[model samples]
Target chain A: MKTKKLINDPKVIIEEMLEGIVAAHPKHVRQVEGAPRAVVALNGPRKGKVGLVIGGGSGHEPTFVGFVGKGLADACPIGNVFASPPPDPIYECAKAASGGAGVLFMYGNYAGDVMNFDMAAEMAGMDEIEVRTVLTTDDIASAPLDQKEKRRGVAGNFFIFKIAGAACDTMKPLDECERLARKANAHTYTMGVCLSPCSLPQTQKYSFELGPDEMEIGMGIHGEPGVAKGPIQTADAVTDAIMDKILGEMKPNKGDKVAVLVNSLGATPLMELYLLNRRVKQRLDQVGVSIHQTWVGNYCTSLEMAGASITLLHLDDELTGLLDHPCDCAMFRAG
Target chain B: MKTKKLINDPKVIIEEMLEGIVAAHPKHVRQVEGAPRAVVALNGPRKGKVGLVIGGGSGHEPTFVGFVGKGLADACPIGNVFASPPPDPIYECAKAASGGAGVLFMYGNYAGDVMNFDMAAEMAGMDEIEVRTVLTTDDIASAPLDQKEKRRGVAGNFFIFKIAGAACDTMKPLDECERLARKANAHTYTMGVCLSPCSLPQTQKYSFELGPDEMEIGMGIHGEPGVAKGPIQTADAVTDAIMDKILGEMKPNKGDKVAVLVNSLGATPLMELYLLNRRVKQRLDQVGVSIHQTWVGNYCTSLEMAGASITLLHLDDELTGLLDHPCDCAMFRAG
Candidate 1:
């Protein structure tokens, strides 16, 4: 079947989307000079404040770009579709977002991103601008417990970024912000199940395929092979399966508090997410772990893939305060 | 093909979804006493303040229920999928939401909704609680200009509700709040295109059907017939067709400002919406009209249908101020 998408030429798709975002949120972000792939916040970067720079592949709208604004991300270097951006835009983003205090780079743990962002860090270092890196590895299903560092990040990036943004916006030192970001990542866990595949704009081709009645659990956002593939199950069953792995690793005690995010992969409707939330809350309540706050929506997505993921951020006093901090972004806001 | 949903039982889908929403946002809303179908904001209603109650069918998430919170809707009466609520729940919502100043009911213009809400208003009258209502008729494609009252409400309900919420939260009387809501509805226009059909939960059958390469423009949210159907066209072409109708209706002078909403009906992604936004901005620029603000997301949806809609709200000072007012809701927020 022909790919049914509302787009013009795919080559200009990323550019058009960037232009659209800028046009819609002129007060929040602007394209960086000489860096068409980088956008900097209009009100975020200030002297003596730590700067936060976030980036990832395209197609995940509102992930890397929509979060660029005051009290969120100072800048975001965008990639092409599911590919990492080249070093040039990353360098430009670092320069544009850097306040006198320094710049910090944060993104999902992917090889291409690591290589490109590292090269950008080297370039920034040569300019006497201090730089730091914090990688997100929150997908609990991507690796064994002992190999957690090898795991891929997914929707859990939302909470990690929120905490880092709060730290930077509060003028936390570079070391402190990096420490908090790492801490946030360590406390986060996520797992997802995919019911269908998403197509690429350029090729108009499906990234992967599944039977109409099938589902793949622990699938990577880029259609990477998942841990299990089987017949689709009820919402409660799926929630239990994913939460089993998360709870096994988290092992929260009674009276513990955690923030929850039931995120759509892409095409899944809010109705399904709410159904999942119902089961998630039931499981958490059984364990005596109170939910500090909950967010349910399409925070992270894989084009139009049909699925959902649940993210838990085990919270403490500091983390809860950070999560509740005021923030204003083009696509997300909290107070 | 089998319907791939994460639901346990379609019979209890609405109840489960409502339970999930309350569980995730206990601080924002709660079920009204003895009224299982009604939810009242925990922080919205106040003595001597006009109370705002918004409701409709269940499939459109974040429309009526998600907008219940401080400075937004005081209560929401939910219905079955794509159907209107019964009069008992509507009356219960009015009672629970009413402050001493009175209550204002707002919802999309539909036969069942009109009839039921009218009955609820009558019930409220016997209780000595004054009530007023303003029905939204913003879908310009649903009727001719000479018979505009016959038009249906669509995604434009977002802006209309936002304005009415601000009006009531600011302590406006029922008459004034109702007037402002009527004014907001008059200034809004919307049009939508459907690419695929959504299935009802109970039957798990498609609500409507179209060929693989076909798209229907001006389709209603509930799969009502549209004005035209043809092979899917390029994004730009489709955008032009929709914008042409909108511009013909809204003949603004140079420098006119308006708020724009590029809404996903369900399965459409942000990538497509941004593409639509790009063309939308191009079209507005050509006409010398400026966008005061733009929102692109799934504000109102038709289950898991694949489609998009564009809504424009012609803004004057009062409407602009209300749109910019602070709001804290479960699924939407602004400041």
Candidate 2:
């Protein structure tokens, strides 16, 4: 395989990306000095609003950082591509986004992020800035359904963040915000597949290998191997496979209202995502599940992997209203 | 080269992509029916505001479509892959964005886009909706300064869009908006290097080819051959080469206020863009052009090419103010 020189050094790449992100959305987000890698909401400390902070890696453009604004994550502690931010940066971000009301550390269920955010939450607690953690364990394929707590987080995170952030945006108490976030997590399920592997910029080699016609199903976003491998199939076939697994695990009842998210895993085109969404919608309709809203695009990506994921979120009146809430961020808007 | 099967047939790709774009930023942007390929501002009829519309190809995600909102292009017409949109889409977009006020079509100076946009302008005139066209011809290498009108546009287009969009947002006259956009095009210059080729989904083959260690300098966003190709070098050297050419042609004076944009040609990493930005800032500073603002990211792209471009826009008071103007778009915001 051929390799191209990377555009920047790894150390300061996320910081510079943050600079561009802040400049692009100055009114919505701001960068913290001591925590240059962290981006916080410009109108944060909404004076009694529960602040929600989320972050993981940087290369996932628009993930933790781009979503930092009203109706979303309050601040993001960006690390290197697919790497967790150090504990110090995470702590500072928690402090910065925290109002007198307290802060929620909502991060993907990755070991690195979990450990660092836990450390940061502990540190924030010492500073009298109340802190809590709500890990998104929505990737059902990542673990057994009986042990959902061990599932990895995936694009379904956007759903959790949206509902949780909306509650906070409306000045929900810290406990209420955390409760809503957990509830959202419980109802959400995501499963991903990958056709290509990501190359670490410094290494310039695939982190994992895949046969040309082979794809990994139930894969994590970071190019990690999945629970199963299968021959590449049609968009509908792939969508059916993912939907069957997710719905079977989620076990949505007939007539249940849910939101569907067909997330492009990095390099999948919109045409493919929509095709997959169509299949997913059709399958759900046949099963008597009503999709209240649907999002088809690249939300959670894994570098340049040409694949997609399906995330289903069961919704109630409050959750549905929160999901429909308006947002203004550089990369996404829920309304 | 090997080919992989994507999820969908080519027939309905653009339609689905547009739908996803609208769903992604529903409040800020939506699709116009007759203009099936156009994404227009959701906030219609801004009373006295001048409307700005810009577009060309489809694969340059976030460039034409992502820029449609307040303080930016009011609408965008998307073509397939690197192709230019037909006149009908552009005309429908211009009509939708126009609110009795005149409209400015600020598109990159590519033959297809220019021809179609001109046709759209003529159609708009027939409808009595005043319209003007401002072509961005910032690729100095594409044409000699004496023949600037023939130059092709590249990454410097962001400058024209920002400045002209801000003026329009302020309800500036159509003539004023066009003049500012033209001025921005004159002061701006860009040079790009492509480390790899990007493939069209339909073709499933690279638009063009490049060697493992060869980089194309002065490359257009489309797959057109670059001005020159050379042995790949260090990030600093590559950045210096691109910046020297752009700055020398721009002839930025000492202490000249300027804005710098380091654009990724798609697959380039954030780290690489920052490294290139570092070298570009140092080179420009050595030449006495102080960077008043710096933007580094994937703004205008060429599919998934692994490369980056450097853009320098000489900023006067008006240009700087425009650069500083407030914007609220799906992908970019500036204030």
Candidate 3:
């Protein structure tokens, strides 16, 4: 089967894409002093503020790099498509984002990211900069309640990063920022449905397979196996099936307030995503769940896969304040 | 051929999508009093500014609708999937955006849009409200230089609308706003390539067809035919092929400053768009063309088509200020 892609060498796409990103927003971001894959904020970084750092694979853009700006991640070490960034760049990001208050490393939890970011933290420690890690485990379908630690992070990373970044903007200590990020991750629940598989540039092969008339729910961002595979269903039915799982795990009360996100997974059109959002709001309204804030569109993606994910971040008073804190980044902004 | 989509009923998708957009952004936009398809900014319209109204087919998501907000378009009348909005919504949009000052009507130059918008303008005139129109013909590949007026608009609509909106924000009169929009359109050039066709929900069939191993350069956003078709090429080569025609039409000289946009037509990933941008800047660098600002993303999309478009807008001092004006909307915002 032939795959559609535009690249000179799939092998060097990371380097090329990073160069383009920095060139596009030189005033907002730049390459970390010496690291090619590590990017840092250019205009504003206050001294003695807890520096926020994020890292992950490159495919889910706007995630790691787009979030690197004022009131968001101070620096981001980018990796190849669907693969964790190298420790060298991660260490460099920590170094560049360092303030007297120290740095916090946050990212979706995967074996590769966990290992590499942990190693990078250790390397940064040798340089006398304190670094903390907050791994997002928000995909409810990835693990049972008793084993939440094993769940993979998905689109829920948006809320976690946003809250953490906003907290950091207040000049809070690194520990407080890390705590808020962990709280955001804990309150967030997400489930994704993949209608089709996405291919990598080098392989020309899909990361996973489904029939022309099938969907897989709870699929990981890297196309890892999901909880279920079923025949194609209507938008309403699909939302019901995925929401049933998310809400069941969340167990929200009638008066609970939640931030809702209906995110597109790569190739899904905005028209379809908007349609799905209508269904999501209808379901939430039926359940008496008050939507505090709603975001819909391509926040997180998996290259060209056709699918979407719904995330609900149950908010308490403190969580609400943290989320409502204003922050402006390349891909996201809130007040 | 069957198409995979996440939608309820094709007939009601337009209504559903509009509802979803407003529900998620009640603070930013709303449905016009009597017109469901005509959306207006929730913020009050000023008394003396030339109200900006834009509209076109619906499938172009943010292009025609998401741009409605402060410092951007005041209203957008939406049509069905890739079809021209009727005179009803267009007229209603003008009426809703009217603030005693005349309204400025601008949109892509499609036969349907032209005819319908003209009808709407005539209806508004009957009510004693002044309206002027500017049709964007930025797609350099759609027609030869001799037939420039026949060219279709693509991603260049972003620049045209941004500048026009900034002009309207500054309380420019209708004639001045119209002139600025026309100038922006004239200074903009765009070229697109299509690797696959997107389907309309009503018809679960691909809008057009191409070989699995081929792509069409200069294809219209609505799957209209282009100037050439060929096998898939490297990102550099594809960028070169498209830029050659654009630069030839633009004839940009050394030291000329411009805004560059590498837009995903639909399914192309950020990774690919960035790679393409790298090539675009390289080519421009070779010719001493300086990029004033750059954007890379899915600015204007065609459902889920698998390709991208590149737009270059030559900028003078005035145009640069207009582009730099801050505007916050559902899908776009800049400073």
lDDT of 2 by residue, B167-188 (tens): 8888888888888888888889
Report the alpha-carbon TM-score of model 1 versus the true structure: 0.99
- Candidate 1 vs candidate 3: the DockQ winner is 1
Ranking by lDDT: 1, 3, 2
* Candidate 1 structure quality by residue, lDDT tens digits, A23-133: 888988899988888999999999998899999899887798989888889999989999999888999988898888989999999999999999999999999888999
lDDT of 3 by residue, A1-335 (tens): 76888888888888898877877777778887778888888743678888889879988876778888888789899988888998999999888888778899999989999999999999999999999999999998888889999989989999998898888888888878989988999999999999888898889788778888888888888888888888878888888988888788888889989998988888998888888788888888888898898888888898888899999999999989988987766666677
lDDT of 3 by residue, B74-153 (tens): 99999998989999999998888898899999999899999999999999999998999989999998888899899888
TM-score of chain A, model number 3: 0.97
Candidate 2 has a TM-score of: 0.83
Q: Which should have the higher lDDT, number 2 or number 3? A: 3
Deviation in Å, model 2, residue B110 alpha carbon: 2.4
Alpha carbon lDDT of residue A25, candidate 3?
A: 75
- Report, to 2 decimal places, the DockQ of model 3: 0.75
TM-score of chain B of 3: 0.98
Error of 2 at B163 (Å): 3.6
Candidate 1 lDDT, B1-335, residue by residue in tens? 76788899889999999999999999999999899899999999989989888999999997879999998899999999989999999999999888878999899999999999999999999999899988999998899999998999999999999999999999988888988999999999999999999998888789778998999999999998999999998888989999999989988889999999999998899989989999999999999999999999999999888989999999999999999999988888887
Question: Quick one: how many clashes does candidate 2 have?
Answer: 7
lDDT of 2: 0.78
TM-score top scorer = 1
